[model samples]
Every structure is written in structure tokens, then in C-alpha cells.
Target chain A: MLYIDSISKGIVIDHIRAGAGFSIFKYLDLDKADFTVALIINAPSKKLGKKDLIKIENKIDLDLAMLGFIDPNITVNIIEGEKIVEKINLSLPRRVEGIIECKNPRCVTSMERNIVHKFVLMDEKDGVYKCEYCDQIYSWEG
Target chain B: MLQGKHLIDPEDFSIEELGSILELAEDMLNNQAKFKDVCNGQILGTLFYEPSTRTRFSFEAAMIRLGGRVIGFAEPGSSSVMKGESIPDTIRTVASYVDIIAMRHPKEGAPKYASYYSPIPIINAGDGGHQHPTQMLTDLFTIKEVKGKLSNLTIGLCGDLKFGRTVHSLIKAMSRYENVKFLLISPNELQIPEYIRTEILANKDIPFTEVERLEDVIDSLDILYMTRVQKERFFNEADYIRLKDSYILDKEKLKLAKDDLSILHPFPRVNEISYEIDEDPRACYFDQLKYGMYVRMALIAKLLGVA
Candidate 1:
């Protein structure tokens, strides 16, 4: 029974995995924003037992697909004039760059400092991203 | 269809393309004189950023045997690379003089990166623990030539499976065939990575088992692929010493294996296989070494569209 005011013009990133809201907040650099942003953690939901939500009172260019890649269970709500305008569903991103790193130490990106780390989705069901240069499988968690 | 193709990974080609290369390799092996001057007056540029005697010699021999001349540097110090030239610049310049470029670089994916810029076909000789498609081609050639077929065999891959690039590529290539079972023998610290186990084996529904000892599974193998526990791959000297001698294939261990079990190693083997085992007829490493040259011959000519 937690309540927060809905935004008239903004985006609400919903259905974030419980305890992952702060990471998404920091990942998006929300702290540097001039507009009001609220990160709600451990919110009860029907789809997920507990989830995290981020309400931003500004229309910013967010890559919802990338957010989906970070956690596929995520949903994004675009609001205008206190009404839901659009809902974006996220899925595994086919290509990602600079957001994550290849864990393989022998990867070419590990050796060449100037190279950009890029990965392409190899398996959607498994959420596998392989390094573009060295073909090393990249995982977010060790 | 292989002409002007850059071999970055074994999976880069379809099974039919690989079969074509294998077919050409057999043709060249049986009738060397018939295709002796296939690449006559053509040139092969070998750009070795890392020091490699066996791989460099094999490519050079393959080109020379096909009546092609060799040009290029063995090490970076001798080339313009010493001037801090980028890989793209060097490959672009080298492509102008040679029909195809075979490069071994210290940085992984360097050849793949170079292939993006070079006009000629780029053969990756060895890229830092990354895909060495040519070596895998040589390995497949060895297995197919000796075993009389490539399908329906139990392959035991032993030692340093984690860091052995040859083993990684070979596993990916062999998993394409039917009825291929993998007995992945390695210490707990050197087990095959989860990506490989899950992606290559589990995804393909290829049967495989992980074990610590070679002796426990040697008798059941149709082919035993041995790899060195390289000191360079170890994080510390203590772990290197502790696991280095764990699986030496002496005569005692060989007795436990099948008589027809073909022993293959991507050489300069460092004490993994005992020198005494060199006398055994099943010891195919030396002949396998010869097959490396033939396979490279087939690969080079096919890439150049000369064969």
C-alpha cells in the first residue's frame, strides 16, 4: 500500500527486478538530472512478487531496449498530460556497445585501449552476448 | 566460393565449404604434382606480429609447394610495425603486393580487424587465444585422413581445456558432425568454460562428460587430443607446476588406450606426450604435422581461387 504521485509528462520505468532499481538509476546517471526523479524499490506487484520502479518527470531519450537487455522483465510507460501515451515492451537487444564489457581477459578489447567494446546477441533465450572482436561470451555477472 | 573469403572462425564457413576444402586437401595430398604450380607466380604475405616457427613454416611451405613465393616478416621488429603502424595500415599496404595475407598477431581479433581493411583474403595464423581457423582446419584434416571418417567417434580432449584455443575451435568444429561425443578431461581449475559447455555442447545436444583423469577415459576414445599445460596460461608458477605433469601420456598410459586411437597434438608439445611414444604407429602427431602443411595448401589455394 505504497503510493506516489503520477507524472504528467515523463517516463516510468516499471517492472524492474526487486533490488535492481538503484543499479538502473546509477546506470542511467539519474543523479545528474535537473528534473525530478524518484526510484521506488521493493514495490509489490502481481507479475513480480516485489519490483522496483523509476518515475522521471521529463521526456528523455532512453533506450528501453537496452533496459530490457539489462533485465528483460522491465516495462516503460510514457506519460503526457497525466494520461498513459505509450507503453514500450523490452526484449533482449541484438547489439550493444559501451554499456557492458567483455569479461574475457584475452579479448582484443582488453589489449587495445582505444577499441570500443561491442557485443552481439548470440542466444536470446540464454541472453548470451559475444564480443565483436574476439568472439568471447560476455556476462554481466561473473 | 572460398575465393577471397577471410577465415576468422571455423563457423564462418558452411559445412559444404569446409567439405570442399577437405576434398581439395585430399586431392593435393594424393597428386602433388598435378597441382604443384596452382599458385605459380602468386605471392603469399606472412605478417607475423608474434614469433611462431611451426605455423609460419607450415604456411610458407604450403605456398612454396604450390609454386607460390613468400614475402613478409617473421616478427614486428623487422617490419614497419616497429614504427608503430596500425594493423589496418600494414594490412592495407601488404594486400597490394600479395594475393593473400596470413597473419599471426599478439592481440586477439587482430586478423579479423585487419580483414575489415585489407583487399585480399586474410588467413588467421594465430590470434591471441582466439579463433585459429587454419589450425582447426589442419586438425580436422588430420582426423578425417587418419580415422577414414569424421563422424560417429568419441573424442577425448585432455589438459588445459580452459586456455587451449586449438581445443576450443576443434570442439566447435567437431560438434557439427553426427554422433560426436566429447570426453572433456581436465583438472577442476582447467575445466572447459561454461559458454562452450552450454552453447556448443548442450545447445547442439552433443553428449559430453567432464572428468579429471585421462586414464579413467582413455580406453573409450577413438581419438585423444593432448594439449600442453602452458606456463604462459597460468596465473602463477605454483599452479603451473602442480598441474603440468598431471596427464603425461607415457607408454604406461598409452597401453590403456585403444590400439587404433589416433593421438593428435598441435605441436611444439612441451612434455605432454613422452618422446618415447613417438615410435608408436598410432603416434600421428608427426604425420599430423605434415597434414598441417597440406591443409594450409588447400586453404590458401582455395582462398586465392587458384586450386
Candidate 2:
């Protein structure tokens, strides 16, 4: 029953888990970007009982892996002339840098400065990721 | 194929590659004099960001016996690291002088991090309580040399399995072999990490059993790998005092073990193996200690492509 105007050429990030909309908003820097983005939260979803949706009114290059890391079920629909042109389906990212820190106090990343925290996807189904430097296991909530 | 490779984990090398290194180590053990000058012109950088006298000495000795020179600091205080030089930068600087580097740090994955920026070969001597591939290599060499095989045996990993990187690497490396079962013995507080339990053992369908007492399973083991169990892991003094004596491998416990059972330990011992167990024929820690050096020699030679 909620209505928002569709963008002619932009992206639609749909099916975000209900509570995860803010994180995706911050990850996209939508608040600071020079464009119009409408964040619709708690929208009724067919797959997810309730979901969050993001509508960007201008085309932007998104870090799909970051979005996938935030929520894998998110669908990124690219639109042109108000018609969907492309769809990018994302799974777990193979490697993520500067995100997903190694929480182990004894990890090398903890002992250094200016080192990019790196994690590699070890198991897709299990959402298992491993720190590249220390081998600490990290599980994605998604 | 091992040439210029960094051994960050035991799984870095395939079974055949590990087999090749161990076979070369065995050959070096037999014909020691032939390898005297194999690395005559090379130099090894021993970068011990934290103080580990035994592992540092082992690498230095290994390189020296191969007719190479050793250089580097034993502590961060002696190196530029104290001034906040990063691991990658420090490795890049040291790689200019040495053909290969053996590094040990208190931080897990320090060596792996160094390998990323290092132009030369990087050998992880020990990284926090993370992976220690060479110690695992030393263990595999000792077991294979003693038992004449790496498979069809039950390996009993006793004490501190949770934080013992050597046990983690050994279990992973040996899991690739055929029919190598594991008997993990640790107090409830010091059991193996769940990632290892689910990812490595259970995922591969390897047979394993977790137990608190060692005596109940001493006779079931073909090889007993002992590691120290610290009192701090226990919840209280009463628990530590109650369970402290359970893991000690004394003469009374050794008598219950199999006749040809090989007892191994990564040394710098602390009451894990009583002094009384030293005279036994199967006390392989001393020889295992020596094989630690031999394995390093083989590893360095292979990395430098000199042997």
C-alpha cells in the first residue's frame, strides 16, 4: 500500500532484510552522495515477510560484494528509461579488503598500522569467511 | 614445485610436495655431508619479531649447516620494528639482503603478511597460536621416519588442543593421508577449536573422539603427541590441581601404551612429560627436536632451489 516514484535510470536494491536497510544506506554513502535515494523500510515482501528497499534516482557504481556481504539476498536492478535493463545477482564475495576485521587480538592485523583487513570466502553455503593473515574463522550472518 | 613458496599453512603443499620435502629430509639425514655446501652463496634472514630462542636457533642452524649465513634480530627492540615500521615494509627491506627469510612473531599470520610483500621466500617459523607449518613438518617427519608410514594409524593429540597451532596444522596435513584417525585428549576448557572440528575433521568424515582423560585412551594410540596444558586454562585452582596430573606421561602411564608406540612432543616442555619418561625407547622428542632442524634445512633448500 506504500507508493514511491520510480527512477528512469538508476538502480533498485530490493529485498534487503528489514533491519539491515540502514547499514546498506551507510555502506552506499547515500546520505552524502550528490543524488536522490529513497529508502523504503519494512515493506511487505513475497520472499521475505518484510524487507527494506533502496531506490537510487541516478546511476552509480556500487560495491556489489559489500552489498552482498551486507545481505546476499539483495537484488540489484539497473533501470533505463523506467525499464529494468540489467540485474546483478550477488553471492558471498571471494575477497573483501578493508572490511570484516580480524577480531583475534593476537592476529597480525591487530599489531600493525595502515594494513588493510582482508577476508576470503571459504564456504559459500555455510557463509564461512577466513582472515587471510591469521586464519581466524568469521561467519557472515547472512 | 616448492621453490620460492611460502609455507604459511600445512595445506600450502600437497601430499606429494610434503612427501617430497620429507623424503628429501630423510635423504639429507642419511647423507649429511653431501648437503654441506648446497647453499654456500645464500643468506637467510632470521626475523624473530618476538623472542623464540628454540625456533630461531633451529632456522639459523639449518641454514648454517647448508653452508649459508644468518642475519636478523631476536627481538623487536633490536630491529626498526620498534619505531613502527610495518611488517610488509620491514620484509621488503630485509628481502634485499637475504635469499629467503624465516620469521616468527607473536602475532598470528605475521609471516603470511610478510610473504605478501616479500620478494624472497618467506618461511613462517611460528605465528602466535596460529599455524606453525614447520613444526608440523617436523612432526610428520618424525612420525613417518619412526612408523615407516603416515597413514593407517591413530594419532593421539594430548593437551591444549584448542590453542596449539602445531596440533591444528598437523591434523590438517595428516588428514590428507589415507585412514589417519585422530584421538583428541584435552580438558573441557582446552578442547580443539570448533572451526577445526567442523571444517577439517567432521567435514572430511575423519574419525575422531574427544576425551578429557588420557589414561582411558593411552593404549589405543599409535602415536601420542603431547603438548603442555597450562594451569591458567582451567576455571579455578581446584580444577587445575584436580586435572593437572592427568596429562603427564609418566612411566606408569607409558606402560599402558602400545609396545611400538612413538611418543612425540614439541619441546620446551613444562611437566607434560615427566623427566622419568626420558629414558624410554619411544621418547622421540629429542630426536623429533633434531628433525625440526633437518626439516628446516630441507625446507630452506627447497625454497632456495639449492638441493
Candidate 3:
């Protein structure tokens, strides 16, 4: 295991579902962020069996609700001055706008340019979202 | 309250709203002349991205019968969609010209998407095997007219359950009623999707059963909803060929049904129901066309706030 220094101040997104760390990275646009970021994939966990962890070394504002929609198992810990300040437990977002694209070809957003794909979280425990326009269900499961 | 409402799915209307539409339909059935000119000045814009004679003609006839005018393309080739115009732009442009829109696209949720940008009420004519709310409304109207009530009925949905949008919508719509048991009839290869079975039916505690042969439960069904197994829905032609003739409702099959069993099909059917059975008194499929027109008229008038 490679060791990395603990962040002095920033957000640590932990307990992501196994194999979902890359999606969270892309979903949060962490690739383009101007901050020190450490992505630990396939970390062993007693609860999840295997998981991904993301440590961001900056006080960044983010939609943790949307993150919960991506992976409900995810937990976020905000650290300030190398001490835990806030911890966000993940739960399904009631509604999400523009974070994900509607893949259904018949979805209006697919043909209409520049229209934000708005989704309403229908089943929170299942993390199922339904398109506001066409009622197409999108779950977090592939 | 249904006036100026966008109906994207069968559930978009509350049970009360559905009742209101059904009530209006009943009134129209009793006194057709009273609603003949209900929408005299209103205009309906029909935006069909795919080819559809039955749906397009139904909407146009309904609007015309209500003294409302319709202006739209029968297909995308004539519209700005051929020029690569986005659906939002087309809907935005059409909203400026019409009081309401009846849109049909090959995509599953096109109308729902358009509803976001449209200022006027948007009726989903059919969206890419996703929804056909008006058709479901018409079906309910037909069922009530024939059977005298929407509840306490066993409806058997046969053929292509996986790709049949009408079956899916009707199932969802009827699930709202009391004692609506479903006898899902189809080949194992063409069985209803699991989500519909588990989420829509089982989750709601609606009693249902799956069967491969229609003849097995024909005597028990109050309504026999037949659908064509479309060639387009299958990936492998061999699979389509094998399943295409699985359930042909011939005169012999009709012998198994009840005397008052109402048979319906959302048409352009290919070989699902034999022509010999069309003369049977129980075949209410043809009547569905007329009821479809009247129900659509009620829907349009209600959506436009005329009724």
C-alpha cells in the first residue's frame, strides 16, 4: 500500500461503492480542479468489502446530495486545520438537475439542444431517478 | 382543474381527473352536439417525428370534430427536425402558434422532455414505446362503456409485452382502479419487463399472473387486450419469427372466451387477430377507434380549458 500525507484542510469523500470511485471523480469534475487530490481505489473496508476514497486538499463547495445519488454508500468528511469539521452521511437526492445526461433516445433532452436533463429521485433506498419529462427510470445500477 | 394540464404519462392525471375526463366522455357520448363546437377557436399543433396514420388522424379528427383547427407535420421529413432543429426549439416555436400540442416521437420520453419547454399543455400522443396516455384514456373509456365500470375486471394483455407501450400504459393506468386483476399473456421470450411486474404491479399489491398461452385463461378474462409482436422490437429475426405467430386469436380461440368478453387492439395489427373474428360481437377493437377519437376530443378540450 502506498502512503499519502493527510490533508490539513479540505474534504474527504469516503466509503464510495467499490469500482465507483472513477465515476465520482468524473461526476465531481475533480480532474479539472486546481487543488491537490488523492484518489485511492479498491481500499479494503469491513462494511463495503472494497471501496474508493477521494481526498481533496481544498475547501471546496460541492453538492453532497448529488453525490449521494451517485453512490448512497458514500460519506463525506470535511476537515479544517487537520481536524474533522463536518461529516455528511449519504442519502438519495430528492431531485437532481444537469448532473447526469438522460441516455434514452426518446428523451427530449437527447434531441433538444441545451435543455438540462432534470430527474426526480423516486426510490431513495434504490437510488432510482425518473426523468421529469418522459418518466424514464434511471437507477444507479449498471 | 384538468384544463391546461400536460399529460405526459397515464398517471399525470389523478384518479379524479381521469374520472373527470371519463365523465366528460360519457357526456359527449350522450350529447355529441353539445361539444361539437367546444374548441372552435383553439388550435392544436401535432408534432409527429415518426409515421403514424391512426394517431395523427385521430387527433386531427378529434380537433376538427370539436371545431378546432390542426396544423402540423405527419412526419419529421416536413418539419424543421429534418433541418436538425432541436426538440426544445421546435416545441418553443410551436408553443407560440398553438394553444396545445400533441406530440409523438419514437423516443421514450420525448413529450415529457418537450413539456419542460412548452408553455402550453402537452399531450403525449406516443413516445418511443414509453407512453401513450390518451390511448390508455380511450381504452378506459371503451372499457367503461362496454363493461359499465373500470373496476372488478380481469384484463389479459397478450403479445409483445416487453415492447408494447400500450400494454404497459394501460396496465399502469388500470392498476389505479379497484380489483383490477391482470392476466399477463405472452411467450416467455416476450414476457412483461420485470420492473413493470415488480414495481408497478407487485409493489402496488396488485394481483397478477403470467401465462404463455391466451387460450388457457380466455374464459376468465373480462377483457382481452391483444397486441402485435412487432418485427422491429426484436434484435434477432429468428427470435421474431419464432414468436410472431405464438398467439393468433382465431375463431377457435374465440370459442374459449366469455360471451361478453370485450376484445381490443391498438391497431395496425399484423396477424395477431384473424379477420374472421372481426365479425364477432365481442370484438370491440373497431369501436376503440371511434372511442379513441371522442376520448381524444375530450382530452384536447379539457387540456385547452374548453370543457
Q: Each candidate's lDDT (Cα)? A: 0.88, 0.88, 0.87
Highest DockQ scorer: 2
User: How close is every model to the real structure, measured as TM-score?
Assistant: 0.89, 0.95, 0.89
* Local error of candidate 1 at residue B162 (angstroms): 1.7
Looking at model 2, residue B299 earns an lDDT score of: 95
Candidate 2 ranges beyond 4 A from true positions: B230-246
* TM-score, cand. 3 vs. native: 0.89
Docking class of 3: medium
User: Which residue window of length 10 is worst by lDDT in model 1 chain B?
Assistant: B126-135
At residue A79, candidate 1 shows an lDDT of: 98
Candidate 2 lDDT over B1-307, as tens digits, reads 9898888888899989999999889988999999999999899999987767668989999999999999999988988998989988899899998899998888888888888898889988888777789999999999998999999999999988877878888899988999999999998877888778887899899999999888999999999999976553344798667766667888989889999999999877889899998989989999999999899999999999988
DockQ of each: 0.48, 0.78, 0.53
lDDT of 2 by residue, A1-142 (tens): 9899999999999889999998889888899978889999999988999999999999888999888898888899999999999998877889988977889888888978888899988888989988888778999886
**Model 3 chain B poorest ten-residue lDDT run:** B190-199
Q: Candidate 1: which docking quality band?
A: acceptable
Top candidate when judged by TM-score against the true structure: 2
RMSD of each: 2.9, 2.1, 3.0
Task: Estimate, for each residue in B120-221, the C-alpha lDDT of model 1 and write its tens digit.
Answer: 899988887666788899899999989989999999999989878788889999999999999999999998867688878997899999999998999999
